[model samples]
Target: MISASSQQKKQLQKYTMLEGERKQGQFPLLEMSHLLYGGKDQFDKFLERQNFFDTNPMFKVNHDFYNKSRQDQILLNAERTVEAMKKLSLGDPNYYTPNVLCPQGIFISTVHFAMVIPAFQVLASDDQITKWMTSLKNFSAIGCYAQTELGHGSDVQNLQTVAVFDKQTTEFVIHTPNIEATKFWPGELGLYCEFALVFAQLQVDGKGYGVHPFWIRIRDKETHKPLSGIEIGDIGPKMGYAVKDNGFMSFDHFRAPLDSLLNRYIKVSRDGKVERQGNPKVGYGSMMYMRNILCDQYTKFGGRALTIAVRYSLYRKQFKDDNKQEIRILDYQLQQQKLFPLLAEFYACVFGSIKIKELVNDNFNRISQSNDFSLLGLTHAVLSGAKANYTYFVSNCAEWCRLSCGGHGFAHYSGLPIIFFEMSPNITLEGENTILNLQLARYLLKQLQHIVSKPSAVPEFFKFLSLETVKVDDVTTIDNLIKLLGLNCAILTKYAAQKLMTHSDMKESWDTKSGIALAKAASTFIPYFNMLCFLDTINNKAKETKEILTILARIYGITMLLNNMQGLLLKNQLNSQQIKTLQDTRESLYPIIRTNALCLVEAQGLSDNSLQSLIAPKEGDVYMNMYNFASKENSLNKQQVHNGINYIQKMREVNAKL
Candidate 1:
């Protein structure tokens, strides 16, 4: 084994080699990356944010952050949040900067900004905004999105927390009837947040109006104690995303003012009479907002995971070549296959996210301008599938990146494990993948409802549904792969619609029985939509980026094809030779991608401080960095000396005596 001193001495050679590798790229990677960031201006913001986080002592991870206890982490997160907000507000209040620059996963403040604030932005009335927006911005009233209850998550319509409009007092009495009705997993609610935009069943004159948003103050501002009629506390540790302060809260006839109902589009008189002007589904504005936010987050987080995996795979040398020279792990075909496809998928996600966000914004804007919710259902359907598919797939990508790191990936020091914690919960939160598939599947079937009568009225995606016969030839190109995938969806949708029509006699809906088919149809749209978006992104870009991006998009399409092979094969959409073609195409592209692997990851511009991986430093000083990370009180070059009185040695002696 090399000594610590020797590891330090060889670090310079590693840095030189890594610099040479970084300089090997042919494309203008830095300029090309601006497209992923939205534009050059946004990329500049990202760089500035990175510099601030990297330089700020307050933001620094001085020790093993994963080693911190929940309470310690909470304190650290709160402190950093304050400092970050102060600095972020000094010039441009680009709220997105915090989320994009946050080295850690979603934090306490992230929920406030991403969910609660956006919800208010889209849903709150002018007066309501005037009343509460200041409190939210100035940190006088930190807010939590209290939506998911212990029993009724995803089924928002069935939530049990009731806020009844009291006729005499003109007040809404909010109550959580049982333990299961408690708001269970809202971030920032456990300790820090003082307020919540609570979702509860609204009752007026004994008639129920399904779940509606209520502005409720849970804790006192000065003392930070739960209010008289509310019970609030932390939900404790979870599978992942534990760094954020997810918490539980319940109410005991909590009396809030009539104005607290967030009645932007509706009004309630003193006599408990309800007046409304807009669609109630428009109340889903908040949910829609978050789903869009998550689409972008998947790309960013996926990029981070691939950055670590790709960088480490390059920096760490493994088995020797025939010439007795140590070979980089990335030199191997298997490593390239594992990482490059993920790299490609990350780009696809980038393009898809931008498009999806734009679509969501357009939908919201239309509604805001004219109360036009005609396209709301369609947009929601798409978002439901996008959230479910993207989160489920990208979270798995992070895990794949972890696994690709081999045994060392299992270690916390590699930073891949942290990516798992950051990404895994996204699959379940917002909406669970299976349930969301069913939701979108239901919407897809709705489109077929009128297809037989008014065929041309159906959306472009379902245009193939009316076709008598469809034939897709060899899938040599990305477009062909996407067409094959689209054909698979058309088949699944038609099959599902037929099953429903034929089996209307069943006790439950046919969907309950044939849910698997519905989910499969929904899940596989994953690649089709992303491929289209990626191609669109490529078409809009200049020739310089279009070259590298087209190659990446092809690889992404192939990877997605391989992943859906079983479904495609079972559906007869892809034949044996076609599948082999896809495999061959992916393999052919690997070397070309490997040539720019370091360049591609570098394009993501992830700071070493943000990554926190001992294995993924830009300088490529793997051994020395690892040594430094393990030095001092962490585990200095000291003997394994005993405790208080050399008890380990004494125990050995005692064992000998025995």
Candidate 2:
């Protein structure tokens, strides 16, 4: 190990070097933060929350926490999470921010905040909400959204859990009809929550009413013990989220009050009668909300992952040129190629998430106030595609960031491994990326058909499908690039529609077989939408900000095009010469982006305390931080002689005697 004094000297030198790099940026970093946070006041509020969490002991974790056994990690996380909630008074007005509970990035009680509360807010009747909302908001009763079963994940329609009404008792007897009906993969259900918003098929008078949400208490709130007829326990450790107690649950004729049915959309009467109101699709509102939130989460996750990699790349030096001075990895063309494009992607995700949030909120309000369900289908299609596409991008880019940092990334202290693992589940959860993309394609084909029937009545977003293709003088401009993507989506959607029409007699089987093509058509539209969002963000900016953002936007658009070159060629969206030009243009944008990379990452407004990566301190004192973290906090380094070494020595002695 290097001596402490030597480490300190190296750290100081790197810190000085990083400062010099920061000074070279063309724009003020704070201005970028303002843009990222939506406004200066919002950025200030974020900082206030971040500072509060940083100073609170309940949110702090030892560096060696990562070295603990999974059970120990879960216990620590649970204890700290509950303590933080109690002190912070979660569920109060604006009290729950994503970072406050999980400062180190592992989600604690996320199901309670993201899934359970939203389930109630969207699905529960006003009377039911009034009865239960107080207890929920006070954290007197914790809950999880239990929908996925052992046999069903994305296929919610096929879930086997059953809720049969008992007219005599005025209750619903919820049961796991078979082993496949056991609820699985609920975030807080295992050992934390006392209740769940369980999804099961409702039965009234021996007739099925399809799947619906029911609030069922599974555990004693005071005792934290499983209640009668409820069997619940944690699933084993996963690739990540060691801290989360993701659980499985089985019910044996579990009884819940008749009011337990969240009946804002549909209700069950005491005499076993059913009253259906509003649209059946209103049940999907909670899911759309969560998917929108996931988009925002992806932006933050991608930003932090890139921040760690980019900052470290600037501080870490390798291979010396002929001058005998080692070069920073960020200066290399290959490194720039890997890291800068992701920075652009991070920005795109940030802006795209903002747009999605606005769209979802506006549609939800219109649906609630005016009972206008006309926009629900469009909202679902857009949010589902955005969730899938953004999550996939964040997951892949996080892995790229990890790989770019070399071996240091594999270590827990680097922060990349945790981000990659935590974000990986997003691709599968909310909705599986491929399945969601296919659903988006179905929606698109329907929209295209509508446009064909009524060209002048197309939705604003889909109006491009009705436009005639015009020859472009400059293919590199954002407008032309977006047009090309729109053309590609239209072409792909048309082909998918034709295939569906040809197999109308065997629609189910045809859809199953053509799933891949349908998913690709959906995937093409996401980047197009993302580019539109990015363009909108820059269109209203000041001259300097616009120039920088335009560069980043072009980098994002061109990189996406090059990566999907085969699809573009197959659809004839770009000729060979245009593809070559895109490649060359992408290469030229790298250095311009790299020049502003540090400033862009700094603009994310992530504090060193929240990052908790030894190699990515804002001050750039990585060598010293690594030394202190390993020497002081790593359990393996605390002793001169290891227990394993002694065990091996005893075994060797016994072998000699034998």
Candidate 3:
């Protein structure tokens, strides 16, 4: 009888529960993983790299990473950086980027590989790349991107750091003219980086040539100290990126060699003559390249948080059921209500980002291969909005996922809090989201103006500007929802554009009254694009998994439509009945989706180590691990009674019996 009860207990264990969920999955797991990771080869690489870290004792994480002090974390980060560079097989160009084997969030040298080197690849000449790219990519030298200033974060045109061409010495004198001009907030710049791709105003013969990227050695190789005439140190204490040293710098008229000027677009001669090969506007593109790439990465970043939350929800139980047995929290409709749409939305974001990444790569190729920058404006506009909206979506939902896990999410052991804090910075990074929203609006207005004058010349992407029909009937259909959103975009864009046109000075108009409207307009455009991406992926890529994907798509499409339909409702573009239908359609999906929750989240392919959570072990034994980690590994647990010096003897005297 005891053995039977034991077996029954084993059957009810979360391990068995989660395993059962996995078995109930509608589609094959490997097939889904292959699709999510892009393809078979890519997924294989992910496994290979993931396995390397998984098996390697050196990469094993111990202790609560959250409890680590800044200094300790920084030291550990640096050590890991070196170890990863030594053990990993990287440097295969696009096939094996350096950060591929790295952690999800920012590391000590992330900016070097992700931002600094990529900047040099596009902005640096071929010879410059040949000289420095290998060493940087190989982790021999650390670098950072320095662009934002103390006074100016978004206004690139009005930056105060200047690099004046000194023809006599064949050097550029880089200087910070005022305190406000101090270069600030470059990751890894404080304690680690030896070099920086600094953005400063280019002045040759006392004639300004706009701001440009200059490769400069900021720190000594041997001493690892800031070089002469360079002031560099960490900006102490931030909400996140504790391991990363976001730094500040000021140049005391530091003289850099003539070769420091990244001359891919414009060349500077020894005699101080400037040869401009590309338009001045191309400088803006150089800065935006990293921001554009960041758009696609948020979804992947968000998957880490979702994985932990979803897995934990599956294991966590609450009040007993009618059968006098505890039901898993996931059984509650409220829990499903909170998490199912996010799961669907996560997949939707991934599909959309995949398509956006392709466009970004294509636009980059056009600029490099053919010197064709015709699509530059459109690319900038699309990415500005995407980066802004996608970051917000990921950050917002990540927090939502955290809250859905109830009180356990508050524990750093859950890995939820850290992910939320780290992700919070992305909304303001690259370009501040608010500024980017207006930047996107500015780009759309340009396109809108073109379409207004010449109907035939309206670009297909901007053809949404011509969409006037709004459908309230049959709006529950995915295609109809998409069309209605396009119509909404048209209305918002044209309305904001009209507001700007009322004044001769567009900037003044945008700054005063229409900025909020334009921001709304830009935010509206992103989901429209995402839905488009979703439809494309469904049609072309996901035919085999279409059954599950169809449900997911409808859920995502409906939530997005509902989110944006308030304005439409106020304007009578959408009726209450249609809105209710869309919401009802979304609700109907929760049950089917809750059944497949494990399949959907696991498809993202987040590993246990990558998650780094006590509450979310892949084995589904969450509580035991949480207890062991907190009671055993936590620093306070080193002593039976932490810091109770006077009470130690008294406490021991009282604990006579067990």
Q: Which numbered prediction scores highest in lDDT against the true structure? A: 2
lDDT of 1 by residue, 396-465 (tens): 7789989888887887777777777777777888888788888888877777665778776777755644
Candidate 3 to native Cα RMSD, angstroms:
4.1
Better of 2 and 3 by TM-score: 2
Ranking by lDDT: 2, 3, 1
Q: In order, what lDDT does every prediction score?
A: 0.78, 0.81, 0.78
TM-score of each: 0.91, 0.94, 0.92
529-549 in candidate 3: lDDT tens per residue? 888887776675445477788
User: In model 2, what lDDT does residue 550 have?
Assistant: 89
On the 0 to 100 scale, the lDDT of residue 238 in model 2 is: 88
In model 1, how large is the Cα lDDT of residue 114? 70
* Model 2: CA > 4 A from native: 1-12, 86-89, 92-107, 650-658
Off by over 4 Å in 3: 1-12, 89-105, 280-289, 540-544, 644-658
Angstrom error at residue 66, model 2 = 0.5
Give the per-residue lDDT digits (tens) of candidate 2, residues 1-658.
8999998887677678767767777776787898787678877877777777678776654678787888787777767666666556454323444353253434465678777888798889899899998888777778998999999998998999999999999999999989889999998888788989999999999999999999988898678899989999998878887777789999999999998899988888888889999776777787886798788655588888899999999988899988999999998999999998888888888888888888888888998899888778888998889998889888888899999999888888887887888889889998898888988988898788789787765667876665435467777888887887777777767766666666656577455766666777788888888899999988867777888898888888887777754445665657889888888888888887777888888887777767768888788578778788888889988787877898898999999999
What's the lDDT for residue 32 in model 2?
81
